[model samples]
Every structure is written in structure tokens, then in C-alpha cells.
Target: MTRIPELLAPAGDAAALDAAIRSGADAVYLGASLFSARSQAANFAAPQLGQAIDKAHLHGLSVYLALNTLIAQDEMETALQIAGRAAERGVDAIILQDAGLAAELHRYLPDLPLHASTQMTVTDRAGLNMAARLGFSRVILARELTIKEIEGVTAEAKRHHLETEVFVHGALCMSVSGQCLLSSLNGGRSGNRGACAQPCRLPWTLDAAQKDPFPWLSPCDQSLLDGIPDLTRIGVRSLKIEGRMRSADYVGQVVAVYREALDRLQDNNPLNRQERDRARERLLLAFNRGGRFSDRPISGQMGRAFLAGSYSGSYGLFLGTVLKSDPVTGVLTIRSDKASNRTVTRGDVLSVRMSGEDKERASAPVGKISQTSDGWRVQGFHPDVLRTITPGLQVYQMGSQ
Candidate 1:
């Protein structure tokens, strides 16, 4: 029997950690107060980091400390101290990006398990071997590699007794990991140091040749649920989900979906497309960047249309275009487009993204639902939004559902 790869989720905070554990994560990776790539997230402080590790251990889930940021010479001692603290708390592994820091860690704590971060730019079998040689037990592969590339690298890695993990789901960067200078040169915040400003997510106007503004850089979030079986067969050890800044609700929903998908893969029954479709629907409704999901780079078609530039921000799921509306009666008729069968319950929130500009014109919760002679009416467009809803606007559910 093929070994099932671990479902590794990100936990930005305590709540996110709880969600991952309860939603069925096999292991989780998180950052402490400092030396983390996602420094902007609500990272755990020293005390909180220890508490989180203990909490995760209580649930019988392993916690990997993310010391995965570029460390300066002066900060080396502080980083080591944090690593020492992480070791004291019994962290399963320490994910590191800096070679100097890894060397220091190896010198101080020779027995500690180290996993090279994706930020380390480990792409090929040689990079994997370097990590293994440097005393790293596992290596988180770079996100931009093709499936074929990953297969070759993993094969070589396992021969050297190195574990291989890859980002199976979550946000995709436009540039190569740790090599992006847009955030650093453009904003003084280095992505390699974990303080990325996410300038790529913002809309941009094309050069003078074409004066059109679009998010020409933003890549769609990754969803490898369907490819889990294939990847595991190829000797992948872990499937990572990348949303440390997400809400607990989002964390729980995504973890549950992937966990079930993994279970189905390990089962005797054949893969069910309909069941997977339903799971994806729930995933999209819960949280997604462009209101839709996409697979990783595939053969012959990998180069085309991976970017979600038209709308730079999260658009949830595209509900439909506005058929008609009345600002006076507080009712708007909309025929669902993306998923016609999708309905808006009382708790559900929706938004309409103005086409071509990457902006939201009208967004609010569904106050009431009614059917009339004219059409099916959705009530509760904010008072300010009614003036903007003229007609022919695309509707998408707001994320954090």
C-alpha cells in the first residue's frame, strides 16, 4: 500500500491552529513572534508559541516551527534562542531558509530535525541533496516546479533519505520564491525576510503601448486535491496548504475538504467526480481568491492563463449577473451564473465586482429572499450600494463564508 502523505496546514494564530487540528490536519507549521516569512500575520509571541506547541501536542498533532526567514548577522543569537525554545517545546521540526542559521542550529543542537523552507529556492535534486547534506531531514520544494520536475527531484531525494514536501494548495506567487525584489525594491519590505507588501496583488496599468490597468502578476491560488493520489504515488511525503493569514473559518473548511479528499484517495473505491465537485463547491463558497479555483501547471497548457490579473483581489464565488433590481422596494433579481443552483442563505454574504477595474461596487449580506411575478428577489443591498447597482454587474460571494 502506498503511504498517505501528511496534510500540513498553516496556523497564523491560536484560533487557526485549533481549526486545523479539529478539521483533521495531520501536522501543522506556524511562525513564532519573529524570524517568520509571514511577519505581518498575527504570529504567536514567545509564550504563545510554546502554548500553541503544547496545544497541538495535546491534540496528538505535530507542530513545525517556522524559523523560515532570512536572518541578519546581528539577529542570529535571537533566532537561535527561539529555535532553542521551539526545541524545548518539542517541535517536530524547524523549517529554516538561511544556511548560516542552519549551520548555527546544527552546531548548537546537532540532533534537531531541520526542513529547508521553500524560500530557500530548493528546486532540483542537487538542491535537495544540499539540504540533506546540511543536516536537514526534510526539504519543502519550491512552488514553481512542474509535476514532472517534482517527481524527479523527489525520487533523487528519497534515495538520499530526505523527506519531500510541497505546497498542495493556497496562494501562488508571481515570482520565484525568495527571489522576488518587487516587495523589497519597490516597498523596502523584503519578501525574503518575510515582510512582503504584496505589491503583485494590486492592479497595474500596462506600458504606454497599451494603457490598460490589470493585475498582470497575480497567480491564482493552488488546489492540488485532485492530484494527491498521483503525488503520493510519486513518493511525496507531505501535502502543504498555504494560508497562515486566513480566518479560522477558512482554515477549518479547507482542512476538512483536503482531509476528506486524502481519505478518499486511500480508500478502495474509485475516485468520485461528483463527490469531489461538491467538496470543491464547499471550498469555493468558504474561501477563494478569484471566486474560482485552479489546478497547478499541467502539460502542454501550463504556460497559458494561470494569472488572475483582471481582478486582483479575492472575489469569492461568481454568483451571477444582475437581471434586474429596485432601489425603492429593497429587492434585486439575479440569475446565478457560476453555479445556478447556488443559493444565498441568511448568513451568507455576497459582493459584485465591477468588471475590468478590480473593484467591488456593491457588497453586503442577504437580508431576505423572496420570489415575485417579476423574478426571484434577493433583499439587502446596502443603502449606499443601491445607487451603484444599475444592471449588468457580476455578483460574487464575499470570502470568509
Candidate 2:
């Protein structure tokens, strides 16, 4: 009998926590107010952490606390204190990156399960062995591994009795998980310390003649929805979605889609083509880079196509190209493609993007939308916002509400 992999979701705040529970996450990973990799997120305080854990437990969900940042010598005691509090609150596990901290937690709180964070850069059998020696109960494999590599590692992990976790969806860093220093080198913020400024998402240029600033360091968001069957077959313990800085809506929608997929897999009813297409569309509507979801196979090598050089941030659902624009009237005539079958209605939030532009364009709610024989005529954006629009540009649905 194949064991279904656990569907893990991310919760950055109370709303996201509720969203995860309502959307049906088997488990949730969240951070405290301090010492989290996503320090910028509205992390929970000690009281809030206790409440969140209680709420999740009521829903039959496990909560894992993230203490996965590099702890300085002086911060070691405080970090241990945080871990102790979480353990007392009945956190299912604690994820860690610092080996020294892991040793301390093992010695002091011997019963608390420790998960080796991907930030620990564990990839091979040797790393798995090291994690076991350090008293870790689980090891999150690095994101750079191909499916074959993951299979090999999972087999070896069983020998050490260490469960394995893999990232199934969300952002992928250009550099390896734990080794990135570009943020600290270029800016004062250190990714290891959980304060990345995301300088890689910014546009850069190699040639002065180039007109467009390209996000060469940014990779497309990972969507392994299609790979769930394979992962389950290989006995992966958990499938994690990576977004703590994203909105509650994003967390809910993405979790719902993955939840359905996992249920289908467990029931042995794999998604057919049309079902897969609809799932892909729902995911795109929730959030996406301006690229195909799951651009590369889980087993294939990541190449140039994996890079999201064209756009770095979420553009939502791609509507169509602008055939004509009237900046003064704030109307756009668009040739609908991917969103042709979907209905466009009033109050829908829409965004426009021009080729070679790196920054997000001004978005506005639609006051009017009418389908034409050839395309759609959308109206009611602020003229000031429309002034940036032009023909031959792309449009996207940022939100329906």
C-alpha cells in the first residue's frame, strides 16, 4: 500500500492560518515574531503562536515552528528559548538550519523533534547521516535535486530512519538554499539570517545595448502538482508549499488546489487532461510568473527556460494582448487568448504589462467589460493609470474580488 504524502502549507499570519485550515492542509509551517527566515512576514508572537497551534490542533492539523535562521553566538540562548516555548505549546516539530543550535536543542529538549531545514544544504546520503547524528528526525532535501536524485536520497534516508520532505510548489531561488550570499554581499541584509532583500528579483543587464532589464537571477515558481503521483510512489513524507510573504488569498487558493490533487492521488483517481488544465488555470489565477506553470519536468535538468527573465513577480491570469488603447477614456480593446472562455466582469482587478518593463504597471478595477466578435473592450480604469497603457501590451487579472 502506498502511503499518501502529507500536504504542508505555509501560514504567515492569522488569516493565512485560517485559510490553510479551511482549505484542508494536513500540516502548516509558520514562524515566530523573531528569528524566522521570512522576518518581513507578520509572524506570530508567543501568545499568538500558542493560539495558532491550538486552532490547528482542533482541526486535526500539525504545526511546525520555523527557527531556521542562522543564529549568532549571542542569539543562541534566545533561539533556544523560542524553541522551548514552541515545544511547550505542543508544536509537532521544529525546523533548524544552524548545526550548533540543533546540537543544543537536542541536548536540552531531547524529546523535541528537529527537522533539518533545506537551509542546512542537505542533499546526499552523507548529509542525511549527519542530520541523523545531529538528532534530526527529518531532513528537507535541497530544491535543486532532480526527481531521480530525490528517489536515491529517500531510499538512503530510510536507512537512517529520517523522514524526507520536498518542496512541491512556490518560489525557487537561483542559488542553492543555504549557500546564497548575494543579498548580504550586495546589501546589508543576510538571507542566512532570514532577512533577504530579494535583490535577485531586480532587473540586471549584461550588455549596454540591451533595452530591457532582465531578471536573470529569478527562476519561475515551482508547481509540482503534476508530480504528486510520482512523489507518493517514491514514499516522500511531505510536500511543502513555500510562500510566507504572500497574501492569505494566495495561501488559501494554492492549498485548496493541492489538497484536491492529493485527495485524488490517494483515491487512485488521477486527474485527466481537462481536470489538470482546470487545476493549472486555478493555480495561475491565484499567482504565477509570466511563464508556463511547471515549465520543466521534475526529473529533467533545469536550463535557460527555467529562468523567469521576462517577469519576476506574480502577474495572475494572463488575459490577452491589447489591440487598442484610449488613455484619455481609460478603455482598452484586447485580443483575448488564455482568458477567452472565462468571463470578465465589473470590479475585477486587472493589470497591464509592457514588453521589457521590469516594474508592475498600475492596476485598476473594471467598471465595464463587453465581449466583441474579435476580443474584449474593458473600461473604467483611472485615466492617469491608463496613460501608461499602449497597444501591443499584455493584460492580466490580478484579482476577481
Q: Where does candidate 1 stray beyond 4 Å?
A: 298-300, 354-357, 371-376, 399-401
lDDT of 2 by residue, 1-401 (tens): 34689999999999999999999999999999888999999999999999999999999999999999989999999999999999998999999999999999999999999999998888898899799999999999987788888899999999999999999888878788746899998888999888998878888887999887778887778898888888888889999999999889999999999999888877878788789888888888777776555535465865777776666567677678888878766678888875447767888788888766755566778889898977789897777776677777877777666
Question: Evaluated with lDDT, which candidate comes out highest?
Answer: 2
- lDDT score, candidate 2, position 36: 95
Model 2: colliding residue pairs: none
Which lDDT value does model 1 have at 242?
93
lDDT of 1: 0.82
In model 1, pairs of residues that clash are 291-316
Tens digits of per-residue lDDT for model 1, 1-401: 34688999999998999999999999999998898989989999989999999999999898999998889999999999999988998999999999999999988999899999988878886797789778998999988777888898889898889989988778888888656899988889988888998888876777777776667777777787677777888989999999998888888999999988887777745358888787888877766666566676622146535776566556577777788778887777876664446656775777876665467877778889875444357888865567678688877766433
TM-score, candidate number 1: 0.93
